[model samples]
Target: PCPQHRERALARQARLTKPPGSLGRLEGVAVELAALQASDRPDLDAVAITVFAADHGVCAEGVSAFPQAVTGQMIANFVTGGAAISVLARHLDARLEVVNLGTVAPPPVSDGVVDETIAPGTDNLAVRPAMSPEQLDAALAAGDRAAARAAEAGARLFVGGEMGIGNTTSASAVACALLGKPARSLTGPGTGLDRYGVGRKVAVIERALRRHADPRDPLQALASVGGFEIAALAGAFIGAAARGLVVLVDGFIVTVAALAAVRLRPELRPWLVFSHQSAEPGHVRLLQTLEAEPLLCLDLRLGEGSGAALAVPLLRQACALHNEMATFEDAGVQDRS
Candidate 1:
């Protein structure tokens, strides 16, 4: 359906009195958005960044080098306008919102932070389910509500980021489940883990997989090892797409959540623009599965929407070119090619 609309947009672009292909990828991106919105004149009014914070039980397995407290600390950093996402959001001139999906420790009082915790922390997946079905539903509802609020605030674009220690482990497990791959194939050194730390992370994931490998229920698999913030991010993807908002996907962990959203609703794929390919091993596999080509490849592995936030300027430039570029006929330039 998008391709059909895109075809019409391309025809319109060609007849705009311009030499074909003068605008390069900007033309293509604009045409794609025109198809997505079914409008020849597409606009990106405002950008919103949602950072979902949660704590993973797998951190108890020594899978991440960072302490679980770091999740809450980073939330504070986000509120205080000191984190990478804070600076990136400022650079993009986008509004930032933080959601306390679930953190191990009590969050500090801060402006622009929404308290929507599903639980204090997930159960250790090495031994039990990370969250119950009710908790997952609540997390998804929280995301939906947040997206509604952002949409009401006139945000046309959204970026999904995460702030949870050991979340990479949860992301890896979700990727393994979705791709039907071994944990070793998807595992990477998260948060600057050493060789032994990497091994420990892989082993923990493998053990969790062995403990719960049934493929009949994807959500069940997620609940067995995924984090609340991850489920909420997945929900945000669904909510954004359902509301016809453009979604900018971040790095590996966010991609896993996007994959989960795709699994839940295949139609949501068209609204997504992947931001970057991360150094995380599972990221490539997930991107390939989604048939997504990222806009950047800076070897970035940090979460917090650092890559998506960085790519917003480029997207804005694309929009500018689409709306403002001069046609060859208007400029009196001959199309010799």
Candidate 2:
């Protein structure tokens, strides 16, 4: 039933005023959207971005050069409309909402900010689980709530991003667990870590993966090393897809979250549109596992939905070509060869 609508949409698209296969993947995207909405005409009216911010106690393990406090500060930056994501969201006409899924500091109040903290921050996964099962459940629930709110606010497209100092470590660990790969393969320079810093990060992730390696139980693996923001992003992906909203995935961290979401609900995979391939080494492995081909490969490692936000214009253009361009029949042109 879910894919049926998409199949019908593709059929209708082939019959549209254009020659078959002329628009390439753009035509595919339009057909996919039409099927997703169960309508011939699919319009991306509004976009909503949820930037989930959390803190990682694993930062104490010297995995990151930056302190944990930076997570909360960046959330403030997002709220003050000065962060990269803020600029991108404004430019893309997206409604950006910063959610405090769990930050290490006392919550700061700001306009366009939601206090959805599950706790101050996750525990240091280097020694123990990042969050308890109950805390993880609550964080996931918060994501579902956020998605519901975004849908209510007229968001037909969703972009997920995250902010946490040592989250790349957590993301690498999660990627390893989900992909059954060694930590070294998925680890990358997060937040501008140098060669030595990258080595430290890889060591930290290897230790975490060895400490908890149960591919059969992804949720447990996630709880072991994943941040609250990543868990919430997974939930957001599920909620958006279940509601038939197009979910645009960002860089390494967001891809990790999306992978976890797919593990939880395999059916949600169709609603995903990979935005770009990150410079992070682990991103390609994750993409291969998901069998996803991203629209861009700009070597972007920046998180905060910047990559996905950048790809939105291209997706819009795809829709424009599908809907606005005159077909061969409409233009009275003969198709030859």
**Model 1: residues >4 Å from true position, as ranges?**
1-5, 12-19, 22-24
Give the runs in model 2 whose Cα sits over 4 Å from its true position: 1-20, 107-109, 213-215
C-alpha RMSD of each candidate structure in angstroms? 1.8, 1.9
In candidate 1, which residue pairs clash? none
lDDT of candidate model 1 versus the reference: 0.84
Instruction: Return the lDDT, model 2, position 299.
Output: 90
- What would the per-residue lDDT of candidate 2 be over residues 209-239, giving only the tens digit for each residue? 7777575476987798899999999989999
Candidates' C-alpha lDDT: 0.84, 0.85
Give the distance in Å from residue 295's predicted Cα in candidate 1 to where it truly belongs: 0.8
Q: C-alpha displacement of 111 in model 1, angstroms?
A: 3.2
